[model samples]
Target: MPSDSDPRTDTTVVAAPTPVSAERILEAAHRLGLRYFVDDEGDVGIPWRCVVVHVIFQDTRAVQLRGTWHRIADTEHLAALRSLVEDWNATRIGPKAFLTVGDGGIVRLHGEITYPLDAGMTDAQIDDFVFTGCRLIVALVREAEEVFPDSLRGSLEP
Candidate 1:
């Protein structure tokens, strides 16, 4: 088949998949016991971080799994970062939490936080948030090393 409007009338054009983002890496890390916070209302009343960790299984055996340790981050950039992570998790790492060794054990993890200086947000507050958030992420990553398989440890290691 051939068409003037179609650039690749005979050839198939395939687009590459999107890459993962620091947020998703952080999210997965959170599931493995990481935490962070995102300012929602701009009120900044008290420090808020969502922590949800559970264990599920592929069977009815009720086998427990590692929990997530996620903290909060700036709400403005949440959407963009989340999109990046989802893409990375899907394309790069497939749809598995724990990668098997023989199955090309490679995972892409981008641990980052975007805290742009807002005209309204105070510097001291931002500093506090970053300090707390960084500590939480670092601690969780360190602890996860013991639990996560050697092959599946670290940020984006093959």
Candidate 2:
């Protein structure tokens, strides 16, 4: 009914629906056959099946995906974890790898991916992003396993 053209007519105007939303994003990711849940903060995360993949709202215009690979047992474990981070960052684009060492020789490995809103992310794009995150997670887990024989976090299975 000529929604935006010459408002002189008495026809009803229909508002265009928002193409994407946080709920939609999570739904799209779940469609990839992965289980996801929303946190109290309204952000989304996939921690049901494997390592925690924290999907947080960076701003009104962007969303960030992050997950820690593993927490190290002691300072001696730092070397291999850091090497894995270094190698991953060198070879990958987004989802950069990281290692953190805390008091008492505690150490950990992490990963992240940030996507800014453009025209708006499509459902397929959402699925692809989740899949990519999963792939990165698998690689990091494999590295963690290699670092310490007992560093098995979780299996990347259905």
Candidate 3:
């Protein structure tokens, strides 16, 4: 028989997984002391130095953390940017990086990481996921800055 002080004698309580929701994601951001904004579409966005990380839910079954780098590249640089994105995606383990071209041939960079929460998640799991996503995306932006110093239009400080 185990004694009263034995480790096996202590009862452990397990927390049930909480349903995924925008409110829960916002709450996690709040707990991290991050400044976040809700868009007209109810999207939660956390602005970083040169990126805005958005937390979006997909039918409550998955969460996508997306970061948009606020730098513009001309169409002339499309080939180089595409090569960079391809190399980044090939070598990086997380937050798939990609490029988008808008009107007037403006090129933009984006990074995204997704987490499937089909079975829900505990508070600790949610917090860790949010934190990890943000860090990885930010790292991608920093690398972009290093690789294309003249591409940035605004200050990366903040």
Top TM-score prediction, candidate number: 3
Colliding pairs, model 2: 72-107
After TM-score superposition, what is the CA distance of residue 50 in candidate 3 from its true location, in Å? 0.8
Task: Compose the digit string of candidate 3's lDDT tens values, residues 59-96.
Answer: 86788999989888777877877888899899989889
lDDT of each residue in 1-158, candidate 1, tens digit only:
11134466765544322332233333444553444433453111112232232222223222222323342223333343355445544654221222112223333222333333222223333334335444443444443343433442333332
Model 2 over residues 41-97: C-alpha lDDT tens digits?
787778633368887675667776788754445666566667767877898775777
In candidate 3, where is summed lDDT lowest over 10 consecutive residues?
149-158
lDDT computed for candidate 3: 0.84
Whose TM-score is higher: candidate 1's or candidate 3's?
3
Q: Which residue segments of model 2 deviate by more than 4 Å? A: 1-20, 48-50, 151-158
Better of 1 and 3 by lDDT: 3
The positional error of residue 100 in candidate 2, measured at the CA in angstroms, is 2.1
Per-structure clash totals for the candidates: 23, 1, 0
Worst 10 residues of 1 by lDDT: 42-51
Q: What TM-score against the true fold does each predicted structure earn? A: 0.26, 0.71, 0.86
